[model samples]
Target chain A: MNEKVAKLYQERLNRYMTALDCGKPDKVPVSFGIGDWIVKHTENNFQEIFYDWEKSIKAVDDILPEFDVDVFGGGPTLWWPPMWDAIGSKLYKFPGMGLDENSTFQFVEEEYMKAEDYDAFIANPTEWIATTYLPRISTEFENPSSLRGISALIRSSVAFAEYNNYMGASWGKWTVEHGVVGQFTGMTKAPFDTLGDALRSMKGILLDLRRRPEKVAAACEVIVPHNINYALSGAGADTRFPCFAPLHRGSYPFLNPYQWENYYWPSFKAVIEGLWAKGKRTYFYAEGDWTPYLEKIAELPDKSIVFDIDLTDAKKAKEILGGRFCLIGGMPTTLLTYGTPEKVKEQVKRSIDELAGDGGFILGAGGVVMGDAKKENIMAMLEAAREYGTY
Target chain B: MSEKEKKFVPEPGTCTPWKVKMEELGGIPGNEEIVKKDWERLDETAYNFLWFWVHR
Candidate 1:
């Protein structure tokens, strides 16, 4: 263990934790949501890098340090293909499944949970995921009927645990070795998001929200505990960065304020409150534009939640959220990929000026860096943070 | 791209000390065309997945 290397890692961790604490650090912490873009940028093939931990390590190399941000990324965030294959998934198209060799994995949105089956799902969330969801998606578990899908579910869980351990250790090593903290710990999907994303597709959830509102609400109540469990289960909880919960499908376009406040938000809030009660302060990736629901978002206990949001103006987000929650991103992904480095720098500057007040902002893109995102622009974003982000 | 301001440059061995060439970070020279095609197709799916993690 190199003393200086450990010191660098500590320094970066403190910078990230300070920002997460809603206090100004020496500089604004920057982390890119670069997912599969790393593999695409590298000469590595998607299948090899996506599945093999060593291959992914080689694929990502020191790209994180090369760009040099306060926080590290390009972790093995992708769920392994073996699990997907075991499930015989129709939802995602990996490198060879439905996509070409060069592209990142793609997800296809389709209904997996039906409206009428809300009670069955709510009856036992784990059982529903195991018996109902698993068999529906995969051929192997097509007969979870025999053991009530308990065996298959157990196997899948075991596989996930093993795979996650391997990937977590491997990717986590790179982040630490490069003297950077990762972007997130655990990923707990907000209950409503869990419904919309995992069980029900957008169409299904939207229709359920309209026709069977109470049932949808009931289902989310059951999902809250599961979300909390999943988030705290991430490997790096003991470190500087805690876990993260992702709230999805609650944006204005999908649901009005009333719908979001009622159906989507309560369970999501429960996930936050539940995790907080257990002494875990997790970042909430408030997916989609949160302009309509910033007030509701502000109600979370101060400095206990990270409101890493998208599409909303940083100035307004700061005004609304800066007091309580740390803001994680402001640079738009499109701008990072398509615009020049100067434009990227300007965005970084504005975000720092607006959201980095006394330090409560992590400077980065609005969403996961797309495959096409220019590295120069990302470099510029980090450089801009150093220039304008100093406290 | 701007004047070198007083930024927090890490001490020698402060960052990734065994610094590999920046290119080792990965860059596909001519794949910009593939990136474009993949970009257009994945734009909606990507954002959609961001909001909906329905992918297995």
Candidate 2:
């Protein structure tokens, strides 16, 4: 890094680190991502941005100079479509392939892992995932012994490695050029989410809770270690930043208090505790209302998580988790989509007043800002964060 | 594979443990540390690849 870039990087990193530790800094650190929303502003459509790494990075490069934030969340797209294509994976329907080019990708949730496979999965999770889950999910890998299946495996593995390398290089370039600090190092999921979201589908898991509750709990128990390992491995064991865990199913009304306490929170909390033991913190990206579970979530190790507030009551979160843990997210994502720029600024001021008063709070959109989110509203939020976000 | 070997479950974050591989190789005449290090790295990659499918 150049001298100028290094200085900027340190300034941003220190600000971010301070806020993460629940300490007051010179200013409230701002986190922003070039979500799919950026595609609408760019000359290129969703496909090019999702498929081409250069185009994805370029999309961010164009915006980074203007987006003066402490942390750079990420680029326009999450995955390279070609990698999904290579595996013949039925996980998602990418733009231009299954959906219109202008539209964002959609996850194709299914009971990829059947009910009968529970015993096999619980018996040996990794082996079952390799031998059974891969073949079931990837059409090309249906017959792993076959030449086509083996080839698909090779191609997908190569693509996975390449994608990781490209992302690292892209982040490096962004840091050198714009002096951006990334929000999180690695990614993981709650163990129940690992089962429900991908393996069982929401419907399937709900049924299992009624009929095969023990199996569900057992499977999740088996997953706790793997989740910790995956987070560490994916992050290259970096403890400097939290591992991103986009929590689902654990949110309110998804599971009742009884079911959540029995099946969900145990394994999920175990994963968090496990990561914390390894000197890692979890970016608890609570997507929906977690108002009901705030007290239960507080049971986690102090500073072991940076709790995100979306539909969760902000005051309750601050009253409960504030000072002990860093609180992020204040501007509701829907406001960015429909509200005017002035309204966004109003929300920003209110958020800073309510949440950032003490410290341990970062200003950002509450959740993933969709493609329809207005640029004016986003720019307003970024501008207003600086305008009001001071110690 | 033998009956006992068939029942062996690999540890988490590993597809095949180096001990298992070492058993298969009987013993390494050369630098065992070098071979084990490279083997574990590849093993880790394989483990990540397996978990990658479900993680999505």
Candidate 3:
């Protein structure tokens, strides 16, 4: 990196690190993401951004110069569809392949792991995943010993490695050129989500909770260690940045407080504690209303998480989680999509006022901004964050 | 393979650990660290691959 870029990088990194530690910096750090919302602004379609690595970086490159933010969360296109296609994977329907070119990817959730398989999974989770889960999820891998199934595994694994290499290089370029500090190093999930998302599906997990509660708990307990390991391994054991944990099922209404406390919170808390033990903090991406569970979440160690406020009550979050943890997100994602630029700026000002009083706050949109989110609104948000974010 | 052999569960973050592989290989004649390093790297890659499905 050049001397100028290095200085800029240090400034941004210090700003992010300061806010994360719940300490006041010279200014309130801002977190910005290049979501699918950027597609409308660019000439490239969703398919191109999702499939071609170069195009994805270029799309982000086109916008980085314009937006001045402390941390870049990353682009909307999370996966390379060709890897899924290589295995004839039925996981997601990406744009151009299954939907229109302009459309976003869709996850096809199913009960890939049957209820009966709980014991097997608990006994030997990794082996069970390799032997049973792979065959069930990928069409080509139905018969693993068969030539097609074997080849599919090889092709997809190669694609996974290829994508990782490309992303690592892209991130390096972004940091060197744009002096943009990355949002998080590694990725993980709540242990319940590790099962409830792709393996059991929402309906299946809920059914298991009623009929086979003990089994559900056991499965989640088994997932706890693995989730910690995954988070650490995924980040290459980097503790400098927090690991992204897009928490699911722990939010309100998804699980009654009783079910959440028993089945979800134990294993989820274990994962966070395990990461903390290893000197890693989790980026708690709480996407929905978690007002009911604020006290339980606060049980975590100080500075163990960067709490995200999406649909949750922001003022209450500040009141409860304010001084203890770094609080991010205040502008509601809906306001970005439906509200005007004027409203966006207002929300930014309001979020900063309510959340950034004490030093532990980063101004950002609450949750994933969708394709319909307006570019003008996003720009307004970034501009306003700077205008009002000064401490 | 016996039922006991079939139930050789690997540790978390590993599919076939170096210890398990070393046991399977009986004994290594060459430098073990070199082989172990590559083995663990690939094991991590495979672990990431398996976990990728659910994380999505």
Candidate 4:
């Protein structure tokens, strides 16, 4: 490690530790991670790069160097096709919508489970992820030889961190130098969101929430710990901080507060407590309105972090959670995508004004970068943070 | 008073339809009685009035 970067890392880590407890640090920390929206902005032809890791990393490398974000985050595992692939699903692309625009790989071949087969499906998920799903990825990416070659190429590539440990080392150094604290692990979605993607059919999960409440709760209980375990396993003890990106998606507005309390809250509590036990402080990226559950979340270990709450007003969030946990994010991604640079800067300034008071605040977009977000707008957010994020 | 001019008065101490639906679904377990008490505080007119007021 560069001596300067090492010093910076220690300094920022100390500051973050102090700030986590509601104490003011020497300076406010700023960081950014890779999100799908920013990826789209960097690539002219994202679809082509989506399947090709080399191309995708190239796109990321172009942006990260310029952005100088405090923390670096890895992209989603493209090891398999779209998530549905695990369940014998495939995706078809529609041009112009970007990577997320792809349609599900239809379950036309055969139903993996009968309605009665739900029990069998729950008993073992590894069978699905390994035999059923990984085979498809092996078929698509066919070159273990080619992958090895690409891995070597990435060693030389600026965006090589997807494959090499250098990115982590460099980011660790950047955090110290910039006086920014680094969150070691990527974000975890809420258990319900994971269920929608990995465990049940999206429609099946939503219907199950209404029709079979006990089953939904049971399934959530069974699955949430695994998600927490998965996150912790990736984040070794060396990195004390654990973070998750829990996108709310359809599950947010669709479920009433009653369902949220029974199904979602318990699962969430289990994960948070589980991570806390492992000596990891969780930065939960709550992507939707969490106002109804604000009190429930406030019960988490003090000094945990919550990011990007959608519908909950930040002032109210601060009132509810300011003392208990550090609050990060609330800047609307829409303002970055559709609004002018000036608008983006103004919103960032507003976020700093509202949430960055005292301590326990970081700034970021409310959600992942969308495909439409202009490059200039993203830069404007960074610029605004630099100019106004002072204590 | 005209319909628009009439002051919208909500039933005091009532639960909204969402709360009612939640109860019917067995969503709120231990707090059912408390929810019911809060629900019973309002008449139908006041209930609807406050329902829109709190939710909207």
TM-score, each model?
0.82, 0.98, 0.98, 0.68
Q: Where is model 3 more than 4 Å wrong at Cα?
A: B1-6
Compose the digit string of candidate 2's lDDT tens values, residues A285-348: 9999999999999999899999989999999999999999999999999999999999999999
Off-target runs (Cα >4 Å) in candidate 2 are B1-6
Tens-digit lDDT track of model 3 for A156-211 = 99999998888789889999999999999989899899899999999999999999
- Would candidate 3 be rated incorrect, acceptable, medium or high by CAPRI criteria? high
Look at candidate 1 and give me any clashing residue pairs. Answer: A87-A138, A144-A149
Candidate 4 CAPRI classification by DockQ: incorrect
Question: TM-score of chain A for each candidate?
Answer: 0.92, 0.99, 0.99, 0.76
Model-by-model DockQ, in order:
0.05, 0.86, 0.80, 0.01
Specify the highest-DockQ model's number: 2
The candidate maximizing lDDT is 2
Q: What DockQ does candidate 1 have relative to the true complex?
A: 0.05
lDDT of each: 0.68, 0.92, 0.90, 0.55
**CA-based DockQ, model 4:** 0.01
How close to the true structure is residue A152 of candidate 1, measured as C-alpha lDDT?
A: 53
Tens digits of per-residue lDDT for model 1 on B1-56?
13422223222112211122123435566655565555443332222222222323
Task: Supply every candidate's count of residue pairs whose N, Cα or C atoms clash at under 3 angstroms.
Answer: 2, 0, 0, 11
Candidate with better DockQ, 1 vs 2: 2
